[model samples]
Target: MSLGRYVGRRLAITVPVLVGVTALTFSFVHLLPGDAVDAIVGFRDVSAETEAAIRAEYHLDQPVWDQYLLWLRDAITLEFGESPVTGRDVSATIGRRLPATLALGGAAWLLALAIGIPAGIVTAVSAGKPADEVGRLAALAGIATPNFWLGLILLFVFSVRLGWFRVLPPDAPLVSLATVKFLVLPTITLGTAAAALVMRLLRSSMRRELDAPYVTAARARGLPERTVILKHVLRNAFLPVVTVAGLQLAFLVDGAVVVEGIFSWPGMGRLLVRSILRRDYPVIQAIVLVIGIAIVLANLLVDIIYAILDPRIRY
Candidate 1:
């Protein structure tokens, strides 16, 4: 397919995926045993009229499919309804928290790329040497390190023992110089695993590309090592790297929940945890739908990047 046609096809595919996401989110939420209304009303004894009113208010009296349609309709317009726990609008709640998550995710992604790409290139260039072995060992450690544990260790070393950083800020400010400091540990926590994965992928891709006929021809023509690797090898090798980066960027949002919780950063992930704990169906559904849409869109974006990087790529 042509580039435009390929993009169009990808966008077309996204619609059903989003629909399926919404359907599944709604179904699974209702499937969970427990009354959200009961949680909302709390331990107070209530009359039957009040109970009926609460059900009607949330459209719980409607059929399952009907509730799904209502929720989905509001979600399409970005109106995700009120939170059962906080009585706040779900959309507003998400909007407030999303920027923090995005900022952290963006930082982690850039850090991963900055570290992973260079490490991968060096390992590929120095294959079978001590540098390669050391790189592989570090990557292995990074991949094996649990995010929460890494986060806690860093917290103890940096915040508790060294006094280099604060564990939690007294006042959470989204934009400030201190924000960078606030984000450092959490970013490292999330980025380490992603970086390892990217490094491994890039190293393999680079090694494979290095063995190609064009690379041998470039070397035979007396091209400088840097020129051969940068001008020829990296372009081809970057396709899979870009693919991994895009998918990981999507995952970073969800992954932020753990890091955010460990570090006490206010983000969508924390909100998600709270919503789930409270059985706030509307909030949970909205958060999940947003995440699902983000993943689908990220895949589409990767496809676009693929087409740009290699003109031969098609839908």
Candidate 2:
């Protein structure tokens, strides 16, 4: 199928999935054991009348189906209601916070690409050499390390001991120099594991591609080693890498919860944790919906990239 038709098909599939996700998110969040009023106000501090008023004000007294429909309708029109805990508009809060997450995710993704792709290539080319062994070991270590623990260690060594970075400064504007100083440890924390995964996948993919008949043909045709690998081998090898990177982006967005909390970064992950703790159903639902959509779109983009990279793919 044509690219346009392929994209349309993907998006059509995504809509219902998102709707299902929204419904499930709404239900599960509400299912969490707690009174929303008590979540906002300390238990035993509020009168019955005040508690009833809070429930009525937020329409929490409505049936689950009605609440889901109401939220879905508002969300379709980009009206995500106010946060029950903070009394701020959900849209405005997410709008203010999403950029930080995006910036952090983007930085980590770029770092992973910068470190991973080359490492994979070198490891593949070197095979059983010392460089390969060291790269493989490092990747193993990175994959095994917990992001929160890594964040803390980096914070202590870089931010505390060396005084090279800050330990979660007040929410600075994203994409600025000030934010760069704050992002260093968090980026490393988030990217390290992802990079390791990507590196291993890439190395395996490249090795398989190199053994293919076409690679031998290219080499026999007098192509330089660099040309054979870069112009021919890497292209085919990179298809799986592209898919992994896309999924990694999704993982990074969701996994940012731990790193964001550890660093106290003002992002959707941090907001998500806070909303869950405070039983802010609206915020929780909105964040989950957003994240679900993001993952779907990221996968869609990867499909498109696949089509572009290899002409064999079609709808």
The candidate scoring highest on TM-score is 1
TM-score of each: 0.90, 0.87
**Cα deviation in Å at residue 219, candidate 1?**
2.4
For the record, the alpha-carbon RMSD of candidate 1 to the native fold, in angstroms, is 2.3
| Candidate 1 error regions (>4 Å) | 34-48, 63-65, 170-172
Best by lDDT: 1
Q: How many backbone clashes does candidate 2 have?
A: 0
lDDT of each structure? 0.87, 0.85
| Candidate 1 per-residue C-alpha lDDT over 1-315 given as tens digits, one digit per residue, 9 for 90 to 100 | 688888888889888987998898778766777775776688478899999999998898998889888877887899887776788988888888888889899999999999999999999999999999999999999999999999999999999999898889537477787888888998899899889988999999999999999999999999999999988999999999998899987876664778888998888888888877777777887778778888888988998999988999884
Deviation in Å, model 2, residue 194 alpha carbon: 1.2
Once fitted onto the true fold, the runs of candidate 2 whose alpha carbons sit more than 4 angstroms away are 29-67
Ten residues in sequence with the least summed lDDT for candidate 1: 169-178
Model 2 RMSD to the real structure? Answer: 2.9
TM-score of 1: 0.90
